[model samples]
Target: MGFQLTADGFAKTIDALKEHYLIYAPVLKKGTGRFTDTDIVRYDFVNEASEIELERKSDYAFKEFLTPLSETLLFFTEDQVKAADIPDKPVLIFLRSCDLHAVRRQDDMYLNNGWTPDWFFKRRRDLVKFVLIGCKKSYQNCFCVSMGSNRSEDGYVFSVETDGDGFACDVPDTGFVPFFAAGQAADIKPSYVTKNDFEVRVPDQVPGAILKHALWDEYSSRCIGCGRCNYVCPTCTCYTMQDIFYHENGKVGERRRVAAACMVDGFTNVAGGGEYRKSQGERMRYRVLHKISDHKKRFGENMCIGCGRCDDACPEYISYSNILNKVTDAVENLGKEVQ
Candidate 1:
């Protein structure tokens, strides 16, 4: 069923949910960008619905709420150790369709990859519920439609869309019925993007021979290795763990997991000072192949969600979309020669 909520009613409903759930949504943080002269869009805990930013795509994804930029895994002392405590409250997250798909990818890596589930990720995943924020138009760099991540029915508890003077929300899950009782019932359908300014068509098969191909060298000078691409991507899950020691007692403190980017220095470093990818071109090759072929070969889907945040976050303006097109052409030519 669906319901119509006035702006005020929507705020009240979110306030009500605050009693049971910690709400995380994309928010506008004014004067926080690089120059401190522009507004930045990032996920933040919201107490009321008014705090949510629905008009724009966040510069980063909602993954921070789950994986977090940095989080304590455990606390340790000379003789004793304790696991980090999980919050008692549940979590409610608002995300768009592409980001919701990104969550599934993270779940596949953290929860389903190993014999046992990741307790840290699972603990938060189990307590969280998703609310889809309707997308009516495509953003500047977004290619979600091209990646077939424009809509999803199973991940969200409900969806919210703006209509004239009120919000039209559809509650597919019966458990969410209680939340919309205060609003007027209406027949509303969720909005999704049917078209985008950009499109990416990955080849049906990408040969492993492309690994040795020199196509990626174009990025050697263009890429500054700032690592912004992975930082803004919703599906980039690589992380580095750290242990912080107390000043008074070197053996006491906490171990933490901090997000890591493959493009950054020391990512491929080894014990003997050897690095797997010494050049920026090689690093770029590994990243592109992993997103377009390697990950899909194992997971049956591309790791790149086509959210286009990588393109937007690039200081050198490297486009993952363009790289895919080049790879597609190379793979097709390689196929022809073999045949």
Candidate 2:
């Protein structure tokens, strides 16, 4: 069902939902950006409709709630080990269409990658629900239309967007209908972007020779290896483990799974002081291929949802969409040479 709610009505509905779910939405954080006196939009807990930043595209992904930056898996003593505890309360995450699609990639990694699902991830995933934030217009650096994540018709219990002085909501789950009792029922469909400001051409296949192609060398010199792109990417799931020792003998501690970046230093480090993909160019190649080719070869779909947060977060102003086009052009050139 659809509801046309006044601002007050939506606030009341949000209030009602808070009793059952911990709602998280994009909120503007002032003076917390990379620059001085600037702002950024990131996910945080919200109590009312007005607290949600509905107008701006979130610079950060909602994956933080699911796959936190640093998560303690278990505590260990000399003779005992105990699993860490998490809240029993359920969660509702408000996000855009591309992010909703990114959830599928996350599920594929955590739930379907192996014979058994990750118990830690499963516990959190089971208690979570999604709310789609309808996109009224494509934002800058967005290439979701090209990546086929521009529309999400299902998976979310409801959809919400700003409508003039109030809000428009589409509640597909009957369980949520009672919360909007104060709002007027209306014919409503969630808004979605049909076209982005620009399109990205992802090559159907990347040849083996592309690895040695001169295309990657440019990033080596340009990229500073800050890893901002990987951190903001919703589909990047790499993580590293750390055992935090509490005692001098290192007998008591907690094992933490911290988010890792492929493009960052020490990611490819192994024993004997060895590291693979040591160059920034090689790391960039691995990152891009993992998103577009390697994951697709395994899961049958491209891992990139194309929300363009990576492009937005890059301090060096490197355009991921443009690199994708370069890959496509290189692939075409390689094909012609083979003929």
lDDT of each: 0.87, 0.94
State each model's C-alpha RMSD to the native. 1.4, 0.8
lDDT per residue as tens, model 2, 8-98: 9999999999999999899999999889999999999888778999899999999998999999999999999999998789999999999
All candidates' TM-scores?
A: 0.97, 0.99
**After superposition, which runs of candidate 2 have C-alpha atoms over 4 Å from their true positions?**
none
TM-score of 1: 0.97
Candidate 1 residue lDDT tens string, 22-52: 9889999899975649888999988778789
Candidate 2 clashing pairs, residues 3+ apart or interchain? none
The parts of candidate 1 lying over 4 Å away from their true place are 247-250
